[model samples]
Target chain A: MSMQDTASSGVALWRLVADGIERGIADGRFAAGDKLPGEMEIAETYRVNRHTVRRALAALAERGIVRAERGSGTYVEAQKLAYPLRSRTRFSEIVGAEGREPHGRMIEASEDVATRELARELGLKTGAPLVRIEAIRLADRTPICVSTTWLSAELFPGAGTVFAATRSMTKMLEHYGIRDYRRGATRITAGIVDATDAARLDLPLGRPILVVDATDLDLEGKPLVTKHSRFAAERVEFLVEP
Target chain B: MSMQDTASSGVALWRLVADGIERGIADGRFAAGDKLPGEMEIAETYRVNRHTVRRALAALAERGIVRAERGSGTYVEAQKLAYPLRSRTRFSEIVGAEGREPHGRMIEASEDVATRELARELGLKTGAPLVRIEAIRLADRTPICVSTTWLSAELFPGAGTVFAATRSMTKMLEHYGIRDYRRGATRITAGIVDATDAARLDLPLGRPILVVDATDLDLEGKPLVTKHSRFAAERVEFLVEP
Candidate 1:
């Protein structure tokens, strides 16, 4: 039957093709990392035109089930990185434990007055002096997240210089006599990446990003730092630990 | 200046309009539940065409920052529901604690053989008899999530009937002499809503949804149920408790 004939069955043609391929992947007919059939081949097999096949592939790509390479054909996406959310969550440790190289680069650092929202989060007065740092974190050279962190400048003077020397937030805090810290709270919301963040993370505009608004507390339960981090949703999945 | 003149400043007209309105919302000029300016008024204010303003509004709606009403104009979305992720996560309790009435309806229920993935998740043999239940949960008359849950039929006979009567997995399991359960592990991912889910949840197609894969274990840490829940990303934000 033609594609239009199948549409009469109450399912869209493109959706049928997409569901067929998804079932194949689930059944191990198309294994992980396996390149999918070309557009012309999929069209022939489904008795649909190339445009229908392309639409199916686009849907799959948007779901993060498959990825289309620039030169190569479409391929099934590998397992996403499982990021554990716990009291002592650490980015470098999480990526390292996953057997991937973790890297963080400071994009910009400056002294600034805390905004009303930031001040409330950090339990400080608005316009309080703070050290603001913008950084990008990568795993295996793939950009995963971009974070903007704010710290009380009075507590950790010259934190930017220390952080620049050692690309580790823990190490920088340690230099300031803070030995340990834990996650205070984390609020996660989903949003589309804006143009500025899209360019910084090398992601396309309108792609989904997980926004994490978090605070870290010192050993005495005092808020040490407040951060806003945006993670690429397709590259990582947060595993909530209780 | 004309829209073309503003577009030459390295940003698209639609994005500029979106950013302008975003700033207005952030600065409290447009509070939550406030109706946005009409398309013609926005076009006149920004000196852009109605099409560009519509595209900007569409982008905002996609991000869930603003919602469009069919007959009424657009309005900023209210604060998202904060869903806490913990070992003893209870959906009804969560909504009730937030001062909202919780409701659930069974969409489909049947006895089926466990697939490979479901078998692995529940530590059951492949093709084992399973009771599958599909449900949609709502809070304050708004649909929040659609879930598919599977339990071993051998362990919980007549679970489908019990769940249908109770409209709750917890209550249904209690009827089978299983009193308590805890969340074992949760895996979260983001995806666009498909046609079936969009229709069920009253969401627009291509909007983002948070897919949560979780397993609930009994007192002895034996897997009792495996569930996949798709939440409306725009209506809720998950708070990971540590």
Candidate 2:
């Protein structure tokens, strides 16, 4: 049914306007990063008052479908990064394939004893030495995710040093003479970014973040590393490949 | 590093308290859906004032990590539903596997002309006749998602009627003599729920929603149906399998 028909059928008028604009974006009438028309224009087109149009725009902004600038008009938000979850998933490769420059910075690297949860995930003793590397990954200079990776320090001595040099787990694994690995398992959940992640990812407080707890395995299917990565929900989405 | 170490490393006092509580939850000291300690108790434990404790709880509430009840204390939110993405994905099966009763209710159904995007997704000509069905799916009587599914009207005559009777797209296809289908492709993104969806899903306005745009194919690998499903991000997270 048409937006007007829905509005006439008891749906809120402002909501109908919001849905109409959303449909426009979906149909490519308003492309990503394209500025929306002014409030007066939208009001006239939707046959609603400026107040209703303002409410509609507010709703869109709250949804993150559109972003409003102080001096500029509202613009459709950038398209989300389409991250593919595959057997051989690689962050650099994924971001590169999307035609975005990928960069990583090590925030902290240390050797520590595994906690009970970390030990269970990595199949190690609770007191086993673990090399933990905390890092933030960026795509085109936009912070996309913050991750903390843990590995058995016994397996890869000096892992923190190697990772600090390479800033990539894959490259550091190669430095350790392990050539190939695959995704073992991933558990996904949605949560608000904690204070630490919010600052690291440059995300607004309380914004949704996609939490992925994953393990990687060596060619022999032995667990190599367990990591928790939190992606800014507005900037990236995981595409699960069958 | 320890919580105290981070707390002393220049983070805000209130944030440190929040992180400590979050760590407690992660370590199973505070289980999901459990009421947190009283504000006074937490304040004393964290060596902070009651105002700081209240701020920390407010931050947690905004993050969807914990919920505050009127006249009662704040409680940890329930664990998310892990919905796996695989070739032969089935919603009912997923929810049932999670030990929850799956239910679907038809909200709207009609014959409609395909828009360009819909036509491309369904492998039909532009303006082709299609049957559209909008539904709300619940797990354990709690609304989890709202979906809109479309199929070729010529290929599946009476699809709307069959789906209404069965409350299942799989069953409706089965009624048309197609027993098996597989997920062809799925694109997932995160967004704030629009007004209609907020109302239908019984979610608060501006809550995060995980949008899954997917196409299903028959055994012969021909596209049979296309759908857009919006899951409540707080309630469910999609696990994409390789």
Candidate 3:
């Protein structure tokens, strides 16, 4: 129906188009991971302009019901993977249990001096050497998060090299004779993705990202490493455990 | 002096502007909660065009270092409020502890039927009567979150009316003889604000919001109410307490 036909129904025309697509997904007319019809096709089916269909699709993408790939058509989003926050959380273990292959690629590594805040957080002196590493984490070839991790360079000498070689922070720590660590504190916020992280996470610029700042403590309750992770919000949900 | 001068230094012009502003904030040249200079003023100070200044400001806003007010100038953001996701989370208490006034205004409320998912979540029969309430929560007159809450209408008759009059969900629960409740499961995601919620939250469109889906349980471990709260990400940070 045209805008005038649906205008009297008290709902906006774009909303109606969105609701129609939602119903189609609910009724199995559009299956999970299925590519949605082209915007022109949807416009024709709904008897609306392409603009209306585009708005409807944007709404769906915002709701995480579908995702638009660069230069590719939109597809219905699969079920969101649950990422749990708990003591001793392991990314590889979590994704493995979910039947997804987890991969972490080291983007870069640098050795720097800790600022006052970093020194206090890591229980080290100011100007202490620190190893910072950035990596992109993926599950089953789908980019999930971009994480930056920081550790005391003196404590874990050559950590950047180790992490780059193993692509596993846990393995890097193990080489330093630390086999276990527990979560200390986690602070979560949300923000629009910047250009660099958007490309690294394979998300559209301006998409929401869950910013997680966390610290891992050794078994003795000493800070081991601090991490800043930006997760693609549509692809995952964070479960906070009591 | 301009893009050409900054380009040779290996940093984008917009990035230099952003860093200058950030340094201003750090050195107390631009104090928190202080209104920043207008875009034109900033451009003149940085010897760049207004578009470059605008891009720099957008970057700062994305980083939560600044916030733009509609039709007003940008301001350096104050320290973010820490929202702890504990078993007993009281909004008023949290805000009061932060030395800010807390208010909840009911936008709308209605009686409805629980869908299958809602019924499953609330441990009620499908199509059971439900009461849905929408409210905008504020701290010191700044909109923090827009919450949609659902309760079993059969269990708490006239809950919406009670909440509308009291403006406190805790008081409404007290009216229903629920003296105590604890948090159950909490799920967090992030998404761009929709038109309606952006208005309700006084946020710019496309701003990131933290979507928190939480269930409150009675002392007996039965679900009492399920809440979907969208918090303005720039104004608050969620702390996961151990």
Q: After superposition, how far is residue A149 of candidate 3 from its true place, in Å?
A: 0.8
Candidate that scores best on DockQ: 1
Kindly report, for each predicted structure in the order presented, the TM-score of its chain A compared with the true chain A: 0.78, 0.76, 0.76
Q: What TM-score does chain B get in every candidate?
A: 0.79, 0.76, 0.76
Order the numbered candidates by DockQ, best leading: 1, 3, 2
- Winner of 1 and 2 under TM-score: 1
lDDT at position A183, candidate 2: 91
Question: Tens digits of per-residue lDDT for model 1 on A1-242?
Answer: 36444313223567657766865665367889999988999999878889989888887787688999977899996555789988998899999999999999889999999888889889899999999999999999889999999999999899998898899899999999999999998888676566578878876544567878899999888899999898988688888754
Residue-level lDDT of model 3, residues A1-242, one tens digit each, is 66454312223567557756764664357889999988889999878899988887887787688898867898986556689888878889989988999999999999989877778878999899999999999999889999989899888888988998988988989989998989987899887666578779876444568989888999899999988899998788899765
Clashing pairs in 2: none
User: lDDT tens string, model 3, B73-128?
Assistant: 99997467889888899999999999999999999999889888789889999999
| Candidate 1 collision pairs | none
Q: Evaluate every candidate with DockQ and list the scores.
A: 0.38, 0.26, 0.33
Cα deviation of B147, candidate 3, in Å: 0.6
DockQ: the better of candidates 2 and 3? 3
Worst 10 residues of 1 chain B by lDDT: B3-12
